[model samples]
Target chain A: MQPFIQFESVSKSFGSMTVIDSLDLTIHKGEFLSLLGPSGSGKTTILMMLAGFERPTRGTITLDGMRIDQLPPHRREMGVVFQNYALFPHMTVAENVAFPLEMKRLPRHEIARKVARALDMVRLGSLKNRRPSQLSGGQQQRVALTRALVFEPRVILMDEPLGALDKQLREHMQLEIRELHKRLGLTIVFVTHDQSEALTMSDRIAVFNAGKIEQIDSPHAIYDTPRTRFVAQFIGETNLIEADVVNVQNGHATIALGADLAAKVRSGPELQAGQKALFSLRPERMRLGAEPAGDNSLGMTITDCIYHGDHMRVQLARGNFTFTARCERLAGDWTVGTQVVVSFDPRDCTVLTS
Target chain B: MSRASARERMGALLLIVPLLAFLAVFFLWPLWTMVRASVVDNTVSRVLPRTAAAIVSWDGQGLPPAQVHKALIEDLRQAEDQQALGETVRRLNSAVSGFRTLLTRTTNAVRDETNSGAIDLGDLDRRWKEPRFWLALREAVPPYTDRNLLAAVDMKRDAGGAIVSEDPGASANRLIMFRTFLVAAIVTLACATIGLPYAMLAAAVTGWKRTVLLLAVLVPLWTSLLVRTTAWFVLLQNEGLINGALQVLGITDGPLPLIFNRVGVVIAMTHVLLPFMVLPIYSVLLSVPRNLMQAAASMGAGPLRAFWRVLLPLSLPGLMSGSLLVYMVAIGYYITPALVGGANDQMISSVIAFYALGTANWGLAGALGVILLLVTMILYFIYGRLSKSPQLLGA
Candidate 1:
């Protein structure tokens, strides 16, 4: 299917500093795509450009095949949920929700009915008359969301909408917004610097780094098979080892870890023999003992042991590099300075050759 | 009601006592004196008590009887001996312009009437026979009269002791009062109109730009009122910079009448008081999140619409407060209007000065002052009440 929105060679620069370097992306209809990155990664800038608050300095942004970069914010008709909510303090919840429809010049009774329905959708019907200042943080966020949705624009963009909420409330609101998107079949472009939030709520996550997209894939793929060193290190805890590629055959590559140490890793098509590559091994994939046959094993000394409530984290040292292995406490404790054999399946390791 | 709490309360009261004493001595005492002056009418009645009493019995339609005339002479003789004749004459002359000569000559004429039987008080001067003179005396005889208050609005009593308009030439106090409020309102509006956009700009920018904008708005406040008014006078005069610039621009064929008018007064007052409008609004605008405008824009409002819907309403409290400040100061302004205003453009404070200093009529000044104070207090009360709204705080 054709993309509902496309950003082709989009670039943004503020004076001498480039914020978003030549970027290209396509968003499908009714898909909840999240732009995930750390601060200053230009994640929010993409959302701003799509929402018409910013224009791409060098390329074009098309919505449903129509060029919209030159359009003013109001003319673009895209709803934006700000990080601070930004609900109008002087307006009641109902009036805030009715603002867009009023701008469209809807009839008074129709505006009333639509505002009532929108308030009801957010379960803010009882607070329709309360000003934004009178509502709590969570309620205000719901009001902001309802206001954006009430206009029924072609697209909706949220820029760290839940950044201001406490952890528990943020989780709750996250699920609520996810459910709302599913129910409404709305296309949402969410921007957040929170990795876990993007992993939990996005249909597809685009990991951004230094003004360019590092990787774009599903959450499971991004977590399990990050293409670059930055993505693997950013998404979750990973044990990285710099290795020299000994040989590459088909899709498998043999890497030399250290003197008298070797491991097999799954390689991409670009892998070459004698090339240096970094292998990303997840902590949970590494086991405490050499068990589970058909897995590669490495001898190491236990450096430290951390007692987590649900699991135990053991630090393993092999030569100059340190690796962490998450293991169930029921599997038996490994004391510090004790010798241990950490093992992982060769198929689980990703070789990054950048 | 524990001992410690009671002691704390007493300590608080002790701390506040000095402020209360200061307010009483400096503020309340002067206000009470002005209020008393507004309604205090005692000189005529104190000196001519018997005549005052006899005149009350006489019908206002006709003159007093023969016995009243004899009693009036007796009172005048006693008043001269008591050295209260001059005061009595002065008080009555305030009501009737010729009463000073009328009363003083009558007192001298009646002093040697011991052998002269049944001396007619009206025989000394044909003016005394006029009922208007007697009516003026009657109006002045009240211990506490509304005469100053009435004259403040250019109304006075006629020969028949009925309310009537003062002579057209002298009855400009009402017009002056209207012009005072009009000038104040116009200046307030002008200040607000100019200040709102300036404050928005100052608040929107940051760093040195914001600092420069704020300083520009506030630097005028540091100058003295007279200096600013004189500057305006120099700028707005016929051959001044403004007219010269206009002439150079070819906007006008000749120099416009910019000075010595209501426009000059309003322009100068607005310039002098604009910082008052700008500062409050700027502070409020600074508190308003910029994201709200962006949100409005994202919600399909254009820039002007967003400003109108979000920023203007949020800044209303500041606008109202600034307007109140400018209006209060503008209504009571004397220097600006005195320096730049035409005779008809003078506001209430100018007339107050006229009564207090030019004419030495403290009673009329006090009455006008009380009205102005009452208006300002009522506006302040409304402001206090409206400030309870959360929008006013821009939270």
Candidate 2:
């Protein structure tokens, strides 16, 4: 697909601190792409550069084959939804949505009509005359979304727009925003520190760390086949076991899991014989049973079993190596000091060489 | 209330007692006395009690009856305090001219005819025969009057006791009062024009730059008002630094008339009151979120439009308060105008000063002060109403 927005070797610095170092990124049209990372990981800086609020120290940002690095924010034709909503306190809900239309110098009746439709779209029509402070947080968030969407700009940039909401409301807004993105076919570049939010809403997730992109792919791919240890650990809970590769055969390798324990794991092309390999094993993927299932099985003693409402977290140990397995709460009466065979398919474990 | 909360309330009340007592003694007491001075008149009635009582019966058509004359003579003869009699003479003379000599002659004649009974005041002084003089005496006989308050606004009672505007050229109190408002408005506008941008700039910057900008405003505020006015006085003189710089820069062939006029008064007052305008606006600008401007821009507003729509409206409460502060303080300004203003540029404060100190007419001075206080209170009431509205604060 042709790129809608592209950043070519962009670098941003604040005095001596290099925030975004020599970065290259591309966003496709009508794609809900999320830049997910911890704070100070340069995710917001990229969004700001795209919005034209901050300038890159080096290289170019082109939108639709036109250089937009030199453009001012008002001329960029992009809408930004801020973390705190940034609703105009003095203006009513309708007026806040009508600001961009008025800026475009639309006629009074047209602006009024559009503002009404937009407010109605957000189910905030009854609150059109209320001030931002008079509205609840969810209502205010909807107003902000309506305000950003009222202008119908080329693209929309959201900087942690749902970060301030509570859990339930945040989840509800996430779905609402996802439905909107699909309904409008918007090219959105959302910046957030929330991994699940990115996973739930994004068509593509770009995991960022230390001013660099660790990996960028579909949520399934990023989660199942993370390219680096950072991405594996950042996305979800996983146990990284260090092992020495015994041999690489076909697309799989045999690795030692310490204390005479060995497992067959799928290896990437980078893995070789006699090489140290780290493999990621999700806790839920490991099955605990009374009998060994297949090639990747080990008899381990249960160190601790913790009940987690719907699931049981079984901590297993064999010699010096420890591993966790998540099992169904009613699967068995797994207790500490009980011996169990922990098994996993070779496809479930991917050897990572970083 | 619970015992602990009652004790807390008592502690708060105790903390405020000194303030309340100070306000009552130093502020409310003087204010009450001044207001009373404007309307309470007793000097004439006190010295000529019998005359005051008897004059009420005399018809307005002509001179008083013989009993009034006899009563006036008896009152004058019996008056022991020479100073009190002098005050009475001064009060009566101010009402009708030539009462000074007439009262002096009448007092001498009353003393000389002490052995006789029923001495006529008309016979003692021919001026006393005039009904105007008697009318002045009757008008002054009232224990309380609105004469001073009316005169403060350049209105007075005619001989027939109907309210009328004082003849033109008789007094310029009304003119000075209007001028006071005009000067204050001008200074307030100038301060807003300069201070709004200055405060915005101060609020926009950070670290040492903001500190420097604030210090520029604060340094002038910390300086004595008299010293600041004097600095302007030195800088505004024809051969002073401003003119000298202007002449040296060839801005003008001669020194401009920068002093002893409305220009000098406004310039000095604006400079002296600029901090009042800046601080409020600056603090308010600080409270306004910085992202709002960026948000406006991202929504497709240009810099100027964003400022006009977002920043300016948000800063209005500060601007209003600053304007109110500058205007109220400017209206009552005395020293800056006194030193820098010309004769015709004098405001109501100078008029009040002239009445209070120059002529010792405390009633007129107090009346003028009361007018100022009333105007300020009305404006403050309006400001209070405006600021209390949630829309103005953008909350």
Candidate 3:
């Protein structure tokens, strides 16, 4: 996997405020990578720097082993789809899609053929003559996508492209974009704050926080094994418990939840004995039963039980400690004030030092 | 309609009553009067009522019959208002150019004679026997005439009542009209060339920078038009700052002809009318989404190409409206050109002003005014159609 695009020690700032701080990142060829974070977290800035719309305050960016930091956006050979589709209003759909080809100074007949084929590929052949205002939201999004793809540049960058659509339409577009990425084998860098969207669409997700990448891994690995507390909390639901490491042996450590409760958990390299640590336990990993065969168990009372469509979220409490467990809907009618035993396999818990 | 809604509509109508009355009195009434004055003439008929009637039956070939001459003498003797008689003489003199002396002398002669019946007007003045004099009288006999309107365009009816162009060197109204349009078009082009880039610069910035740019355009607009034109007048003089600077910079051997010419008129008018061009373009550029340029760049369009394809097209509505506005205002300009232009460079408005106020030829003034009004209406129609397009709104 050769790196197709690289940002080497990049730092971007506006006046005195820094948006990206000494960042180093690599994007492989034909890989779908997403930069996911909340607003003002600089995820969009990284995408913009890659697209050559913004110059880095320091350091350099290279694409295909060539320096592209100084190049203008037009010469960067990357297609960008904006949040609000910036389609040319004065031009019809066909003309809008043919803009890049015409800029490339391609022959007239060839440009027309490419524009027509691209429009047909997106199922917008009937809308070739319509202006962007005459089209629906979803249709405009499709036209924008087609226009960006018609040029077939080195990579495609999308900045919250589907944020304006309704829920159902957004989900549909998410899958459509994923399909397009796969069929074209494009090296795409997508920016979004929607964690689930990044998870469902990207081959790798870079969870960003405060202008730096917290974790970069496959979506499953990122969700199942987050490297930091921010990544774990940002990705999905989890219960974090303050604990002290009691002992460490090989790749696992024993952490004491309280004076009377202790649990064995898998730890990363930074954990050691006699140090304060945070233990992360996913809600779905806990089992609500009197199962004595598990490596860890605790006796608590059900304080609240919330019914989801397919699962039950039972909140349990024991003295000062509180935990939530997601269990099967038919897991024996757990309700508030019902005493229950919560257990989990030690392999499902992760020990965090920060 | 429901009671409440109907009451609301009534309230809205009442709110607009003052505005409607103002438009009717101050705008529409004057417009109507001017239009009527261009084609309606009754000076001859009012002074010589019986003569006007008697001359209608005359063949208008060689001379009038004896009864028509007797009727003229009777009408002239009975015309007691001296000012009214003078007005009639003045109106007829404009056509034949000798009635001022001829009518005044004849009026005195007819009044002094005790026997007022059967007076032969040829006995008083042999010039009256000339067929041209009677022809001028016959031409003036019509209460409604196209003389002023035809004269506005430098065309007139011959003795046989056929329309023909005025003799060469006789009048320069038509030449001045064409020059007015030409000067306006030149000024419009200058404004567009300078205004488009200025508007884009204003739109590209934000915060205080944008405020500064807009203020640069607006400060000039807030000043009086005459004051601005006067400022240009001082600057364009040969011994003024512009020439002094040019001399210091060694751009030319001597001061160029920067005043009382086409160049001076164009420069001053462009400066005076630039805000009209810039404001519309700036507003339209503001409404256009800023990301379109970036989108073009992302799609492999350089700055020039992106501007030509995306930004320029998007801002075209503003450019067109600005050009039309400048052109319309430029054609009607009087003070600037009069102050800064040479005598030969005066536009049609100067001619209209001379007719309206200088010579008091209100008929010709109104006719020229009607021509200008028609041109403005056509341009406004085009502007209305352009603005109605969805593209103009940046949809």
Candidate 4:
């Protein structure tokens, strides 16, 4: 199927400073794509551009098959949820939800029905008569959601919708929204700076940096097979260790950590003997104080031990450098000041040249 | 029980007492004094209140009483200080020739006080007659009559000459007050209608254009009332900028009558008062969050729809406040109308100023002042109630 929304080399600039560089992206229909980055990385700018609030200095955005860059915001037919909820303080939840329909000049009864359905969708039916101020932050957020969703726009854009919520409510709303997206099969582009939020609610994440997308892929693929050092560093708790590629005779290459620590990676064409390389490995993939589990292992001094109930975070020191690894709590025995070996499967680490 | 709590409570009370005292002295005390004056009866030594502005011991209605006739003659005779009346009429000649007629009628009517006065107050009450007052009681009686102020609105004393509804319709009509209220409301609505777009432009634009617009909007705010009104006078004058431009453009070869008319007064007052509307709405619009409009648009509202449904509705608090401020201030305005309006176009404030300054009738002035205050109080109450109403608040 053709992408529902496409950013075709869409670039945005303010005066001379580019806010979004030449970027091309295709948002598939019925998919939740999260644009995740730190503040000032221009994730929210992309969302605003799609919402038609911000005009791109160059290039065009296409929705369905027609170019949408020139369309005024209201005609674009997209839903947006804001971090502050943006519920009209003056109007009751029902009135706020009914506004878009009212603007369309729909009959009163139809607006009432649609508003009721939207409130029910957000589980805020009882709060229909309450003003935004009368509701809690979570309830207000739900009201905002219901208000945006009442007219049934084909696509919804969320700019850090869960940012204003507390941790528990944010997590609760995340699952709720994820379920709604799946049920409705709505195309949603959610923007957030919270990595966990991106991980929890998205089918795929477009990791952004300095107004550019570093990687865009399925959540697991983004976490497991990040193409660049920045992506691997950004997505999860990955330990980056730079080493000399000492040996590469077979499909695997040996990466020397020091006289004390050395590891190997599954062979790749880019790996060369005597060349320096950096490898990223998830802490959870390594077992501390264990015999070599797979093709690679490192011996180190135990620096710190922290119990995480389900897992143990074991910090290791070798020579003058330190690194951390995790193992199942029951499978590992690690104590501070003890020398030990940390082992991981060779397939778990990715060798990055750039 | 707790030191911190005690300290906080003390601090709060310490903050409150001065403000309470200031209000009591400056507002409540003076208002109480005015009410007291309105009712106080002048006795052998002092004035004693029965109710505000209703201290008529003389029940002069229906039939003539000798002492009331004498008192009426004395008061009217004192009012026609032929020398002062001449000067007063001369001063007003430049402004209105009707002043000279008013002076002549007042002088001639008092000269034949017994033969033909407008109304026979002496007929309404009897005890108003006294031998000393028939000869010379103006100094002893103490000049206090609320008649003229009530007369300004076409109301007067009851049969007893105590302040009461004079005309049957006055109980419902409040004619002059209603007229004043209507004018104020129309001006407010007109200013808000014309000023909102300027405020929106000020809020939405940026760079040099925005700065210029902002300065333009605020220019009137920084101007003195005299200068602003003078500027309007210049623009609205027959041979002034607007008329000259119109003539040059061939809209009319002859200058149109623009100044010294009701239309000119209304136009100038609305222009002068427009800043009051624009500032409040502009401030509110500037503070409105950008996301709400975007959210509306993203939810299928176009730009105009988003503005109408979101921006405009959200802007209403400012609109309400601005209109109320403009209307309330306009109701009490005197100078603009006094200079630019005709006799019929003069508002309640102009009448009050006439009684207070031009005529120097303190009792009547005080009564008119009370009425203006009451009107202001009623307006404030309505504004407070309307702003608090859920429907308006929602808007």
* C-alpha lDDT of all candidate models, in order: 0.86, 0.90, 0.90, 0.76
Residue-by-residue lDDT tens digits, candidate 2, A223-302 = 88888899989998898998889998898899987858889988778889999878789999988888989878899999
Name the weakest run of 10 consecutive residues (lDDT summed) in model 4 chain B: B44-53
Q: Relative to the unseen true structure, what is the C-alpha lDDT of residue B260 in candidate 1, on a scale of 0 to 100? A: 94
Off by over 4 Å in 1: A246-254, A259-262, A290-294, A299-303, A318-321, A330-340, B1-26, B42-85, B92-143, B157-167, B391-394
Per-residue lDDT for B180-264 in model 4, tens only? 7877888898899988888988888889988898788678778887898788878888889999999999999899888777677
lDDT of 1: 0.86
Across B282-318, the per-residue lDDT of candidate 3 in tens digits comes to 9889888888999999999999999999999889999
TM-score of chain B of each: 0.83, 0.88, 0.88, 0.65
Error of 1 at B347 (Å): 1.5
User: Interface RMSD value for candidate 3, one decimal?
Assistant: 1.3
Query: Which stretches of model 4 miss by more than 4 angstroms?
Result: A104-108, A290-292, A307-311, A328-334, B1-37, B41-149, B157-179, B206-215, B342-344, B387-395
Candidate order by DockQ, decreasing, is 2, 3, 4, 1
lDDT at A21 for candidate 4?
Answer: 97
DockQ value for model 1: 0.54
Query: What are the per-residue Cα lDDT tens digits for candidate 1 across A66-161?
Result: 999999999888889999888887788888899999888899999999999888878999999888888999999999899999989999999999
- The candidate that wins on DockQ is 2
**What is the C-alpha DockQ of each candidate?**
0.54, 0.76, 0.65, 0.55
Q: Write the per-residue lDDT of candidate 3 for residues A144-171, one digit (tens) a residue.
A: 9999899999999999999999999999
Candidate 3 chain B: worst 10 consecutive residues by lDDT?
B386-395
Residue A324, candidate 1: Cα error in Å is 2.1
Error (Å) of candidate 2 at residue B285 is 1.5
Q: Cα deviation of B164 in candidate 2 (Å)?
A: 1.6
What's the CA error at residue A215 for candidate 3, in Å? Answer: 0.3
Better of 1 and 4 by lDDT: 1
